[model samples]
Target: MKIGVDYVKVRRSERLIDMTQYLLDHPHDLIPLTFFAARYGSAKSSISEDLAIVKKTFKERGTGLLETIPGAAGGVVFTPSITDEEAKEYIESLAERLSEEDRLLPGGYVYLSDMLGQPDLLRKVGRIIAAQYLDKKVDAVMTVATKGVPIAQAVSYYLNAPFVIVRRDSKITEGSTVSVNYVSGSSERIEKMELSKRSLKRGSRVLIVDDFMKGGGTVNGMKSLIEEFEAELVGITVFAESKFKGERAIDDYNSLLFVQDVDTSTKTITVVPGNCFDKE
Candidate 1:
């Protein structure tokens, strides 16, 4: 290949590193081969070869995936995913931490803010959740305000979709809002939730995420909001669920960990793997 006189020739190793970094930074986005070719002052064929190597490495390491498109308008996109073994190990570690007696809070609630606030853990969570919906063509992620926000944001980061937050109180900044009333699953008291009318469009496919669920009243309320917008609820996932609760308001959902038992008197808790690993 003739090196362009106007541009400095870049080494193959440097090119590979740059290309891989670019793809990882812009996951789920398509970039034309011509763009990379021009940026590196190399031929499109060379760029394609580099991408193939990156794809192989990604698959071999169980990091993520690279999808190539053919033809003149084609390029590549990265999709974040986690291997089953790694995901299982991570969940088992999380459950162990959750079982600690010190994490127990008043009213039988478990404090998980420390784990949720960790960026590394949240990124792993994003990868696992995103992997589940890789083929679902999800349009947006929705969650109730506060605890669910981080999980929704993490999942949306990997999914390359925008996230919508439903608030417990109406905000004037949201302009016109749609509100719904449902019984709080944990407290068994009637509660209200609201979402902005402009935040979501009709017929959008949404994935609901939350940090915890007891009775699933909050998720059920979000479901009603989805109905009000004429959008579809693709799926629901929670970081954890309390097993002590009665029948959930929503049956179709996934949890990463289940709080199987908790005893305030003895300050002990038991946790088990959720239904995500159940053999179908």
Candidate 2:
């Protein structure tokens, strides 16, 4: 081991920096220690020490989790996460934005298209959602077309998983599509949605995300599509959920914001932190 301040020490420091970046870039991916050892021209022992430093820093910073697997075929995986405090803070801010009187629209609809365009906010929301399900073995993210695309993309980015779009209209491009019928949450009218057969694999763990859910009928439609594909429903998350009266279609889901009441007469919208903050 060469340990001069100007030589091996500098290289070690550089290695740690680069290794941390690599792990962050490839979240939820398993990387073998041998690969790191060869890449840095250092022994496995040195790589392990470097990872220990990274692991500690990540934990303390509330950045994420570093999981190490031992044995011959073992490797390390980095999974993104946020502290409860951070999640609550961010969601509270989001709820405030959604609660604005100007966001209220005709027929009690809340306008949300503008917020989806903000990349920074989406990144935080994605990290929060992805972090909550890191242990669920999320293989793919699913969402309905149009509004939910951005949310799904953001979550998939942090989860290091691909996203699939379920469309209102079937396209010839996506061959052999699987379609499902679901009642519209807002209107209570039956509507059809479809997804490409080739987009998801059988038995794969799927995380469903959406922009907004009212009565949860649309989400239930996606759940039906999951069943048709023989994929497992890991969980569901939504950016916001409007107030729904009576029984909802689905029972379990997490949301960043809940629209408690939207009074069109007074143009007042009541928004609050969703159930994801229940433990807090």
Candidate 3:
């Protein structure tokens, strides 16, 4: 019966692995202990012990935070986070890559599609942004489409919040929409952006994110839309911000990278870490 006992141990090990995977995948969500106990046919106490081990490992590795709520209805919720040392290193590397000559585009825009598309980079960005507002109760994440979608999604993933997209044009499928007019930061032309009325609830605390910012017109437009929805703008962040001649449309904001200078003719770009690293 030694083999049978070993098999039982193997099954328990498999259950632990599965439980950890489930918790990691469903960050910011409460999973009932009974659900897991029923799913794995294990005792609640055993599941608690397993989660304790998982939580310890997660803390040691700087993977994320696993919060346990005590009560009959309580369970576990994961909050993704990155250690400071890792965040600093990642941001520094990203600044170097962004400064590459070939990444410079026309009109001083940097080509960042590849970086945004990478799952690893997005996760890092999300964790960094989420860490900043960990203490705050952020109700939702908002971004102006189409480039801002990825960054917003990443941040929302870590924050365990839903995201809403603001479009340049209102779509009929969206039902009712609230439109706001603002100056286009790059073009210096008046432009309008809209969001679905049903997307954001009233009095929500929102965090805004975007891929890039210059004069902050698009971000300002989103801010205005948030006001129209009767929501509060908790904070604003961008992937990168350009050092431009004119004053920025908005003053309070954070960014991951600052494009100090970009020479399209020479194909040279200078980048530095953004306000996110600034000491408050």
Candidate 4:
């Protein structure tokens, strides 16, 4: 391995420096301990110790912050203090990056399917949304078909709860499915799905989750599904929210990605914890 005086400066071990750097660059990004241990050719136990040291030293210095979330979706998140100037600079940088020509898909779309698969990114985004609903007693998560499923899954996993899939159409095993009509992003009529009188219990609190909200139609559909179960709408969480002109259907919600671009080839995406500052 390429070693430098800076690398050797870690007062703990060789891995601590690497670990700190990993967390620094990927603030609020949650990752499994095994993955980092494997990446650095260290043991999970060894890495855990190293992380503890790193977390302690960094937190003491106010240069690092670590959060340990328990459960299947739980992991460590390292976040550094971000200044308002830095936030604006990053957002502008993202806008410029997304304005490139090569990134655009057909039909004036910027496909972000690949980014959703990233574990670290998903975890951080999920934590920010889940933070809003902490101690709210949310039962099951609900989301529309296809792309939104992953976002919903991430939130549900972090919340340590099962996510109810709302399909576009009914399947054989669904058994008396609940259907709701809604308008698509392109102004086309569409219907979303939910299992008929399934897992959601009465008066159960629910947090609506989705990947993107163009017009909040799908969000509303999911809200209506929650109503079908006689559940209380705790809050809505989204990975991204378009600031298009219209009233939002849901009141309390969280979003990581806020801006929407009408013309972009690269479809540069900007993300932040929009809900992290809100009152729970």
Candidate 5:
């Protein structure tokens, strides 16, 4: 916590020890550049050099728990042997920042739709959910068309499961297919989707996923469609759920984000975690 040049002045004498400790304390949260810049407020090139040095030190010390995943949403992940004391500290810090009623929208919505695009966050959540169903016979993932794709894709990636898209309408692209009817939040009457009969094999276990839930009509219809295929509904998962959404018919599920609200007039977005992905 003792930052600034004063910390650096004495660093000329015992730099390596202090630097190694800093990396261990903030393993995953800091980007390499951010980590080094905080220590010295130095240039990007210098920070990169320092990261290289720190990484080498970690390897030589036999502490290979810090891993760097390359690419856009990728960074570091700390697989550590830390005590529950440290884990509690990290969880509490996130909870303090993320838990706020102001994040709720007008009516009863929470706006965490963006986390769907953050691969790093979704990957963590997906792994947790997929682990719960690992021994089960999950054959494929199902979801209503549109926004639900990302969650389905994430779970599919982790489970090595294929995803089946239940479209809102029959498209020429689908050719001959089976269709279903269900009410939607967007409408009260009913909506439809066409899934190729070949898309799912009978008696297969289907894992359903969606982005947001209000009424659960779309997902329910998805579940019913699985029944029609004589397939087992292994489980269902969502990115976010509105508390207002009345009794969900299906229970085995997970959610990453919880919508507090979406104040379109003020253009405010409020969200938190109702699911395990961002919880205490």
Candidate 6:
């Protein structure tokens, strides 16, 4: 409300706070200088100066990258990012928490539902994952059925893209749908998943996300669906992955945490940072 009001100039500190908040709210969006100037009833030169300060702080604090594109058709775009060191440190701590014995489930799956349901944690995870594919020009985020929906939604928020859900069964509400049959990682049974025909268009660049992985069959199935729609696979990421004994169905993907071992008899779980930080 203080912005874009009756040309009443605001204080420098107040303007900076509002401006930073605006940019944070609209990550991955292009905002023109004129828009900021009009919003705060300030001069273009002053707004530019304010942006410089915000950019410096963002960089120094490892918050993200703010880019200024010059010319009439260009504007400022903010990409939410985390420093490698910070991301590694955070992920390591997360891995540590997951290593607790109580986290081990009956079938070697780690209990991650509590963490997945947390908004703050999910937002941090989103920032870490979104930072990785900022340059991929992702049009949408994809996830299968119920469990992966939250992770997909979180990542989509930072990417500023819509998310599509793939269902285990085709729903009548979906109208016409596309289905892919994949081997179930846990049960090793062939299972089918469906996506709405209108969820994605041909040539759409999609990023797939999931909460966890064991045999990677589900993700592989999602990849097949991407091919079916003539869409591109920008990337695939999972929150946690178990140490699979058999050959995995999907080889190329990223995970935040790797479950090195899950001993149900001993009630122990060992978690470590996945290959996400290995690229660094």
**Best candidate according to TM-score:** 2
Better of 4 and 6 by TM-score: 6
RMSD after CA superposition, every candidate:
2.6, 1.8, 1.8, 8.6, 12.0, 3.5
Q: Tens digits of per-residue lDDT for model 1 on 1-280?
A: 3565323345677889899888878888998999899988888888999999999999999879899988878899888788999989999998998999999998877889888899999999898888888788889999998999999999999998999999998888999999999999777899999999999999999999999988899999999999999999999999998884477799998898999998999999899878777733
- Residue-wise lDDT of candidate 2 within 42-156, one digit each (tens)? 9999999999999999999999999899999898999989998898998999889998999988888999999998999989989999987977888899999999999999999
The TM-score that candidate 6 achieves is 0.94
Whole-model lDDT values for every prediction: 0.90, 0.92, 0.89, 0.67, 0.64, 0.90
lDDT of 6 by residue, 1-280 (tens): 6575643444777888998899988998999999998997889888889999999999999888899999997779998889988889999999999998887777766788899889988899999999889778999999987889889999988899999999997678999999989998878999999999999999999999999899999999999999999999999899888788889998888999998987778888889999888775
lDDT of 3: 0.89
Candidate 2 residues lying further than 4 Å off, grouped into runs, are 1-3
Ranking by lDDT: 2, 6, 1, 3, 4, 5
lDDT of 4 by residue, 220-245 (tens): 88887787788888888776666656
The best candidate by lDDT is: 2
Model 1 RMSD in angstroms:
2.6
lDDT pick, better of 3 and 4: 3
Better of 1 and 3 by TM-score: 1
Q: Against the true structure, candidate 2 has what lDDT?
A: 0.92
Q: Is candidate 2 or candidate 6 better by lDDT?
A: 2
Residue-level lDDT for 25 in candidate 6 = 89
Model 2 residue 269 CA deviation in Å: 1.6
